[model samples]
Target chain A: MKKIFLSLIFLAILTTGASAQVKMLSLPQLQKRISNPDTVYVVNFWATWCKPCIEELPYFEKLQATYKSQPLKVLLISMDFESKLPAVKTFARTHKLASEVYLAQRKSDQELIDAINKDWSGALPGTLIVNGKKGIRKFQEQEFTYDELNKLYQTNK
Target chain B: MKKLVLLMLIAVSSMAFKLADGGYKVGDTAADFKLKNVNGKTVSLADYKAAKGYIVVFTCNHCPYAKAYESRIMDLDKKYSAKGYPVIAISPNDPVAEPADSFEKMQELASKKGYTFPYLIDETQDITRAYGAKATPHVYVLQKTAAGNVVKYIGAIDDDTENTKADKVKYVEGAVNALLSGKQPQVTATKAIGCSIKWKKSA
Candidate 1:
């Protein structure tokens, strides 16, 4: 029984260390989530290769943890090329990113960029803080400090 | 006091909006700059007196998107330089933020690639800011006019970022071709997913 318990613990550790499975999200699916009235969605467009995106990830994770009880959901959308899915998965696992992560599936980069925000200019590390309830939609194409992110949530919430 | 406060709010909101909408629009005349090139020589748009126009590309060594488009940029220079539109690449990323984009690394890459065009370094990023380049591989095609260099096209090199050879609509080529044919480019501006310009931390 003790050996079995030890093995279970080891398995649990391995599973936790592995990256949480990521789902493929179409533009429509992403739009639906962003437009949902019940929840405040903090959608971060990132890629495994973007340095600033990687650097600013912890802030998003902190936002997720702080608002665990609230209706705030942090969605990390990986903009890595579809062919680099393995790299994306590896990056998520290596970073041990806790929030819900996804790989974007779309017809083209232009379509995706336009769908997200016309002014985005297709830059990585772009963030969208949307509170459908308050009709508050803010988009920034730069990295945010944890304090700035917290303040954004407080103001929007 | 209420009127003053209302004006202040409007000003603040407008400033915020402008910050988000930063960068050059199509038809805006872009400025010229004297920047250090990889060949240990200073380069400027005016230096190319023989050329009728320029293909100014903001690209770097570090970004994957930039790397993927390297051959295409070289090809653009090769095909068009003699035709009076030479490719002038600028590394716009702050070296402090992205170590790989430092001048030395740029030199190494240029040597390895045997780049025919000048690869200038936007060290202070003043040129980048002036041109409003938000991402790596951002392109601006300028046509020389009686007044000055007129911005004919601004944006991505092509429609497809993944496969350059497979791209159906080569935006840069199309814009340049249109210019050569004495017609306004069908598509003046475009956007593609790319690494954001690595900016220096502001005090």
Candidate 2:
């Protein structure tokens, strides 16, 4: 019984540490991820402090689950400041965000926002759906519902 | 005759759609709105009879970006109000969507911050929609012309959204100063990362 309890605690710590691992990526690296021809990338730009971004996160999660069989990738790219990396990791772990999460490794918000999409106004909750194989891309700078997200994916796919 | 009428209808509808997509672009005349201020009075641009122009800012209490620029906004009002340009802040977020942005909270924040400018409530969000405000702290510097209120600038208050306030390009102030000096603003617009406005659910 003692051995089992000790192993369980160790396992819990491992999982917690694993979940807290958030990758940091530059704009070019992120663009490369989206350019993967085999996968459809639904990259969502959000921050832990943004309420609307948090509100629309579940829809992205649902999209990931619904399209699990397909080569659909939902990337939650956090725009939180570099100083807030610990907070981003904590948020990812607490939310149990199964999707691959990354923090933007850019110097200026303007550069990243413009590179992602010129139409974007550097607002939180920005979403970009890209199917590199099909050469289809859509960007929206607003909160989205599950239906809207799913429809965008399907249409883009 | 029927085909001509149908063609005209399509053209009109397309024009309306384009208008809906855009709000007041630079040089476009801005519309006036009567909104309730935190002091329990209806405030309008027309009410400021002595004003030469207006600095219309769509901001809220809850947004971190807006909070960061609070002092800067107050400073703008203080510096410009006596010079015939006043800052008019409007809370554009729906109260139901964001309770922290409600009217009472606005009044509370205004009193707490000792804001000299009129902090108004855009209850229906129609004023915000008309202005095409996408985020909190979005500013529209309107110059009162002989024709009407012309949008001289539309964008972030400054380049520094993180409140470092160092080496920041003050967009709104630049626009206002240019107008004051009888020259067009060099930088008419700019973008900054900000919290999206909490829009109400459409029924």
Candidate 3:
């Protein structure tokens, strides 16, 4: 009974550790992730403190689940300061989000914002959908619903 | 011919929306506004008869980014109020959309922080819309010229948000200083990661 209990605790810790890995991405690294011709990447720029971003996050998760079998990736890139990484990790863990979570590593916000889309004004809840092969890059600096996300993904396809 | 005219009308309206979305650019004349201050007084940029310019900042109470820059913004008012470039902060958040940014909260924050400048509420949000303010702590430096308040600069207050750097560029200060010295700011605009201005439901 003691062995079984100890192993269960160990298994829980292992799973938690695996899921706690939040990748740090700079502009170039982020660009590389979406460059794959076979995969469609939906990169969402958000922060833990942004209410609107938090509200619409579940929609992205739903979109990811609905397209799980497809060559699509949903990346939630946090715009929170790097010092707030612990808070971001806690948020992702507590929320149990399935999308790939990343912390943006940039020297300046302009570098990342302008690189992604010139139309973007470095606001929270911004999303970018990119398909390298299709040569499609759509960006919206606003919150999205599940149906809207799905429709945008479809239209882009 | 009827279809073409209808299409032209549609195009014109859509173009107006687009123009509204892209707020005030540098060198453009900014319109003055009558907004209620935290002190329960109706204030306008035109009310400051002795002022030469204004450091109009669109900021709010709850945003983490705004909270981080609160002290810095106060310092801007302190250093420039005597110089005629007083900081006039405007809370542009919709109270319905963001309850923490209501007028009461704005007054609470102003008193708690002991703000030196007038912290005003853009009640109608028409001023915010006209200014094209999109983010909290968005800075717009205007110079009182013969034509009117000419926007000298727009964008971030500085280069670093974390406030950890010793050599960070102070964009707002530079603009205000340049205008004081009868010179144009070398750096006119910048971008920073900020909380979006909470628009009312219809907006």
Candidate 4:
């Protein structure tokens, strides 16, 4: 009942005005974004329902803001199923997420996990920070604070 | 120049290895735990004297993936408990980190689902750490032997997380069947997406 109510509100908002666009990123598109040498990509694999992932999202936003003058981009790639895209959009809009969020509609979840980082155990709140210009990439599966995240970004950058 | 490139490659490879490290491998002896079940009874591997094996899963109430596989996990017990392998599920997430997965909630979920298996809580997370479980719904299929409970398979419930696929691979079932037929499973391990085990904050 709550889901239906939320969906109706989301649909109403969608028709009345433009909502935050949550694009489905293919594997190739994702790889391109991460491998782009122009900027460092902090790709966070998360979902709206994941508590720990939600807890750590602010730190990513803080990282993006802290290095606003630098070549850094924080991409919040949501692992939510397609049916939840409306909710995802609503979340972005309501929360006012500064980071860009893309729905990970891949061929398979395992494939997506492997594509992001082979060592990752397909856990939520996983991050892959890539600095293509520096030829460096680090994959970590843990919750992070702004300081911890900033230190990792500084090393990769 | 060649030496510098080689050094970089080495460092990168090691880092990759370390990220996926610290989990139970197939053939390793799994540790026995004395955990509290939903019935308020302390359960352990030794309690199941008649079992030939155990399907020990580290799962929690809060994870959607775990919820998706919940019925299938029950099916595993229904299919194998009489055959000597009873399912034993351990809720590994810290209640502090996720209030929905508290001991009370665990009991509520167990009763609601009418779980036939023991849904235990790892209060200290010692058993969870011992198994090196990184995600909810992570499985470790153990085969009882004179040497102790030997881990025969370590991975997901099946290939299909959504539970709607027609061609889903049952990693746990295959492993159990192999043991029943006196043969080792071909696919010993696999990876599936799941929520990370929420640990208590370090004070």
- In CAPRI terms, model 1 is classed as medium
Q: Mind sharing the TM-score for model 2?
A: 0.90
Instruction: Estimate the TM-score for candidate 4.
Output: 0.86
Instruction: Please provide, for model 2 over B1-203, each residue's C-alpha lDDT reduced to its tens digit, 9 standing for 90 to 100.
Output: 99999999999999866765677789989989999999999999999898889999998999988998899999999999999889999999999989999899999999999999999999888888888888888999999989999999998888777767478888898999999999999988777788888888899
Candidates sorted by lDDT, best first:
3, 1, 2, 4
User: Cα deviation of B47 in candidate 3 (Å)?
Assistant: 0.9
Candidate 4 lDDT over B1-203, as tens digits, reads 99999999999998755643575789888889899999999999999999999999999898988998999999999999999989999999889888999999999999999999999999998788778898989999999999999999998989888777899889899999999999998889888889998888889
User: Model 1: per-residue lDDT, tens digit, B1-203?
Assistant: 99999999999999855743465677877778899999999999999998889999999999999998999999999999999999999999888888999999999999999999999999888888878888888999999887788888999998778883454689999999899888999999888999899888898
- Residue B198, model 1, lDDT: 88
Candidate 1, residue B2: Cα displacement in angstroms equals 29
Top candidate on DockQ is: 3
- The residue pairs found clashing in candidate 2 are none
Docking class of 3: medium
Task: State the number of backbone clashes in model 4.
Answer: 0
lDDT of 2: 0.89
Worst 10 residues of 4 chain B by lDDT: B15-24
Q: Write the per-residue lDDT of candidate 2 for residues A49-129, one digit (tens) a residue.
A: 898899889899889988899999999999988777889999998888888899999867778988888888777989998
